[model samples]
Target: MNFNFLSPVSDSVLAHNELLSAQVLGRKLHIHSKQNGIPDLDGVSIAILGVLENRNDVNYIGEEFELNEIRKSFYALFPGSWNTIIADLGDINKGESVEDTYFALKETISVLVKKNIIPVILGGTQDLTYANYRAYDTLMPMVNLVNVDCKFDLGDSQKPIKNNSFVGKIILEEPYNLFNYATIGYQTYFNSQEEIDLMNKLYFEAYRLGQVSKDITIVEPVLRDANIVSVDLSSVKGAEVSLKQKYSPNGIDGKEICAIARYAGISNKVSSFGIYEYNPSKDDELTSMLVAQMIWYFVEGVNCRVKDDDFSNEDYYQKFITLVDEQELIFYKSLKTGRWWIEIPFLSEVNNKLKRHTLLPCMHQDYIDACNSNVPERWYKAFQKNCL
Candidate 1:
């Protein structure tokens, strides 16, 4: 309820919104403006927030940016045939220090999540993701994060918390609530060997750029089990984004990124979503439009969500059992959605962190792999983490 840290949307954007057609999203959303303070949250399913903090960027040189352009692009777009209500709660300006900014972000997102309202954050730097993770500390026992990035971002925890190193802080910091961390579209050259080794040792998931581009559906299961989904714009290809925002020549394309966003939206567990590392520029129209499309696809997916994971009703899902290496694997296929899940046996005797994560979302291929006598990698990793 304490959103004093938020600033109203810019006057220019509001003026532009007035010129847009009534059918666009600008007219549909309940917006925060100078004239109308904060909008009522009653029946609001999604809230859009912007955070203006990037002092922690490793390549920072005292440059500042704004989210007005992204807002304009998002507002001008047409909405899908959806039933969810959205509100733009405006932006959070930079605080006295980076930690102060993080605190404000944490508090704001915490309030939204507690109300069962998903926050769609447009951010300055990806390090804000650490604050996003912290927002869940009191809400959930353990958290699963799905980061769509080109790097592992597991910098030295002893060093200062830079945008590239915040993940390490999340893992090392007190009140460890992180249950699992996964990275999608990771470029091998961008990550050091030690970070890759550490990821393997930690039993965290990492999907290469080529792996995801080859088949985007691989990320669906990973996202299905996620509680927070954070995306870094730098993971997008140089040709697909603005000059200032591009970081790689080979990365996820605009279409693929939008597909990933839609998958994130469809997941029942994903409560908070963020797209970060935005660098506004004069020639950022293309990037802004792509970001808008990504948001649109996410909203579309959210409207299509189905409650197909309930196993209490025997007729809702069909169960299958297979054995590989003398180990029994149980798989369930949703009769409503055709999605699959593999069961992770509860280790009641051992101190288990995954007592609540018994059903692991998986693909049909995983069932085929188990039928061929090969243990699915996702199931193996989850089982290993549970035993740890």
Candidate 2:
């Protein structure tokens, strides 16, 4: 509860919210303000944290205040069937160094997540993802991260931490809690051959930008099994963001990224999410609105969550078994949501974290492929990672 690092929301932003109607989000939000102090989180399920730290970014390098633009748009929107309470925890300013900022963030994240209040962070740099990953160290024995980015971001682990190299640090760092790392919308040209080979060698998952664009729903299965979802705003096209400094020409479109955000929200396992690399100076009305909608969609998904983990209860799941290459594969389809999950056999001798949850979210096609004597790459990868 020691949120001393958090600064109160600006009077100007609060003034804007005052003008809105009672039905608007601005009125419903429990904002941390100078007059009212940090809002009570008795029933809040989601907290919006604006992180203003970017000294380590490799691109658009500068220090300035953020969150006003994004909050202006996010607060103006109308809520849609959401019963979950949201709090604007204001912003966490940069510290003496990047490590200091990380310490503040890690502590803040740990506090919110332990209370089961998911933190939807609007961040300074994508490298803050390293801090986000570290926040979950004591909360969960293992973690599954899904990053929506144009590049794999597996920069040299030996090098210092930067926007492009945070993922490498997470992989090589101590208390290796990262169980699985998946990259969605990675453009091949943006990543080097060495990093790509390393991703394969380590059994990490990477989905090409084309593969996601071709069938965006395929990402749902990947996200459904994830515990942490981090997005790099630079993955958005330059045209959509209306900023040339960080946006790329070829990447996830605005609508697709919002859809992915919703998918992440719907996952019962996903506890933390951050949209990083947002440049407030370069942002326009459209840019803020896009980010705001992504947040809205995520909140909506959280409200629609249903607990379908009890596969032992026959009434909730349709169990199916298939054989491929003389190996048996079991799949469970939720009768309520039609979501599919494959069973990874329990190994008592293996790490307890890997055995904590045996079900891995997968697609219907994976089961069909198994029936056709073809291995689902998704299952194969998880199997390899766990067995190793």
What is the TM-score of each predicted model, taking all chains together?
0.99, 0.97
Candidate 1 all-Cα RMSD: 0.9
Report the C-alpha lDDT of model 2 over 1-388, residue by residue, as the tens digit.
Answer: 7999999999999999999888899899999999999999999999999899999887554657577989989999999988899999999999999899999999999999999999999998888889999999989888899999988889988989999988999988999899899999998888999999999998999999999999999899889989999999888887787553346788888889999999999999999999988876554787788899999999999998999867878999999999888878999999989999998876688764564658889999899888888999999988888777
Task: Specify the highest-TM-score model's number.
Answer: 1
For candidate 2, the TM-score is 0.97
Candidate 1 lDDT over 105-207, as tens digits, reads 9999999999989999999999999999999999998999999999988999999999899999999998989889999999999999999999999999999
| Stretch of 10 with least lDDT, candidate 2 | 239-248
Error of 1 at 16 (Å): 0.6
Query: Which residue segments of model 2 deviate by more than 4 Å?
Result: 244-246, 347-353
Model 1 spans > 4 angstroms off:
none
lDDT of each candidate versus the true structure? 0.94, 0.89
